[model samples]
Target: MSRETIVLDHLGGHEAAARLIGGRLEDVLIDGAAPRVGTIYRAIADRPVKGQGGMFLRTPDGPAFLRQVRGLAPGQALLVQVTGQAEPGKALPVTQKLLFKSRYAIVTPGAPGLNISRAIRDDDRRDVLMQIARSEMDGGDLGLILRSSCAEGDDDAIAEDIRAMVDLAAAVVADAAGDAEVLTQGDGPHQMAWREWTAPADVITEAGGFEAEGVLDQIALLGVAHVPLSGGASMYVEPTRALIAVDVNTGGDTSPAAGHKANIAAARELPRQLRLRGLGGQITLDLAPMAKKDRRQFEDALRAAFRQDTGETALVGWTPLGHYELQRKRDRAPLEVPQ
Candidate 1:
């Protein structure tokens, strides 16, 4: 058999490819078993982003990240380099729109479908974004942020990015033979705040105030802390129509309840905690019942406290068991409190 062969990004007639090049190419998936690093826009020689987000080097494998040049005009989609497990290759096509991106990022040849676009002005942040794009060549599942990382970036920063990609691509090409399996990670702040919000609830944040990194990581999961209880020395109560027992040894509040004043202060804090924790659904607060006037004072306290509650709450009088019984609405599901 005899035929003509050419690496074509576009073919007018019948085209079967051993190689695809240039800006427009057919999209292809990385080998299912390869390790995928998420869309990189930053440089990281260390750990993954700091968040409660889940990342995996899955089998369906991720797409690619291509570095763009200044003179070139790109199509909606383009050819991408392959950071293959068995070999390093180039010019495979992947979606330029970059959809289904729960975490991974795919940088295109021209204007990428990422948040970091071509018009970035900041030099340092630009360098960071470009470095990150280079790192996404592998098939890792990482939560990434591409929006405006390149916005207002300077030329030097852009140039620094080009250099970073070239170096990274060269290294991948170099190591293709000796090491087939490698993990590539991108840069992150103390944590990836935007990434963690997408995780399932299981991770618990206890105690009070965290470090900068801790706060960032938690922000991704817990979010802006709209309501916080800082629950300590607290007891979970099983509320019944007969009585409500919220054994308040302390809700992690170590304030000495030595006198009536102190106990009242501590008791007053319960409604705040309920609101902060978002606790509701027929709650029976088994607080220490006080004197005859303290009863009215406590009811007054509860009524005042209920004002902060986002959920619906109706306070009944204190029970004979010296417990305060109340009915509070559950906005979502009730939190898992240890009884």
Candidate 2:
């Protein structure tokens, strides 16, 4: 019951919806929710109609503002829907959008199809990357995975996303030549991928209950150890797994064979619980066996000391009843100290 993310970065029409670009607007957000829009590539739409016509081919990396765009010609294709109210002022930027697409080449308003693939015009970036990879192999859409920051990105970020999709397809073809409204855009990169998949002990966290300061700065940036429990306090210490089960409350460091010192603290806490909880699957550690070593080759050298932190994980052995198993990567949870 503790989940919070309140971003407000620059949100208010990228230059007033770049003054009419391929339009599209609907319950966008700034306070509401649902805003992860950053498509890298993958689009399809040959002929269909809803707000008037069809052929959208822009699924992700939003923004398309046009007054005319037509550079990545070749097999030609263009369409857009935009709307506005972007917000920002003292310069702008607060998460603003009104439906924009063109994180690469093609954007029309004609001037020879506006972008000529950043003037390198290799037939205009192979005609918008072969019409977005042949509309994801024969249009019906959804096949994007070209983000290494769009790899060879140059020509000034492909001519500013083809002049922001020819100023959003010349203002959704000028609001289809009349009224207005219906275009939307905004998603400047979801606050750097949520601060690059956050970590800081669940962000200086609070248990089933919650608090803020950006979740205590993401639980003190995931190093965990935020003790204090019971009430107006903290909790996270989580860590343990990669085939775990270290029961060495040690108490006063008393030893002898405190079970081979809890089997060397469960082989040094199973590589710090497979690197702090980013665990892998089939794990099933249950240590405390090393009656002076020889415990099945000291657990096969603890599965060869987890081949340096289970990069590929797959130990897959040790079950004559002592447990261990491995295989790795089970989608998460059990970091350690969880018993």
Candidate 3:
């Protein structure tokens, strides 16, 4: 049976968390110096970039870019939330549509309604959650979405979580009239682990847990490009200023189907590798020398693997040179190697 473990610790003086599945690091979060996603800011509209259909805003952290600026004018202050990490030398990406998310609930301020997560298919459970939502929300103007984590959760705890989120949303909305400043910072690594890693796992909260759980060792491997695969196949993930490049190689495999096997393995492992390294933006895959007929199979494997990923990714199809391309959101900051 597979066992999952969560290690809450620090890396190079920054708070960090890691999820270990059967002694293998699956996910990691580290506090970064950049402005984190989900941070709300009361920002002043700076200038408009009409060609890009977005306006830049002067924020406390730095300049932010917001799209769909229909009526926004310069010098006007408005609330915006950080949606994703900014690329190097780029303005932080901000969105007017803010969502306050927690493990059990997500509060949507402008969109009013109550809804249960679609993953909960049981009619009975849905009814129960709806009752709880109605009681807590009381026909509030804000929207409420009960996350999938509420499917088998304790009623009292879920209700409490809903109330807390509702209160937080209300407080933030009430404080939105302030000058250009940070309204609320994003969750830190420990809080992120609590809010995201909801699966059943052994919690290791004491110090040095990462080292004890072998998370540090696993993270050390992330600094390198090589990743081993089954049957001596391997792939190298290298990030450049323009894009992330993945190259697959069939090492010491003389079989006729070696290329196909290595390519498929690379496809399946690519998502995890990219996620662990916190690499995003344009990704180009130089797959092994597989037949054109096998492209569909390789794509299928890649799609299936990425379906379970948390980051937003779009497979942009094959390039003219038989290479595959993808566009992924920069959801997490690049990992900093420990000194």
C-alpha TM-scores of all predictions: 0.28, 0.21, 0.97
Candidate-wise lDDT, in order: 0.36, 0.35, 0.91
lDDT, residue 33, model 3? 95
248-313, model 1: which lDDT tens digit per residue? 443444444322343355455666455433345556654532455566666676677667543567
Error of 1 at 253 (Å): 14
RMSD of each: 23.2, 21.1, 1.2
Query: What lDDT, from 0 to 1, does candidate 3 have?
Result: 0.91
Q: Higher lDDT: candidate 2 or 3?
A: 3
Off by over 4 Å in 3: none
Q: In model 1, where do residues sit more than 4 Å from their true spots? A: 1-244, 250-259, 336-339
Candidate 3 global Cα RMSD: 1.2
- Per-candidate count of clashing residue pairs (backbone under 3 Å): 35, 87, 0
List model 3 lDDT by residue over 46-88, tens digit each: 9999798999999989899999899888999899999889988
Highest lDDT among the candidates is held by which one?
Answer: 3
The most accurate candidate by TM-score is 3
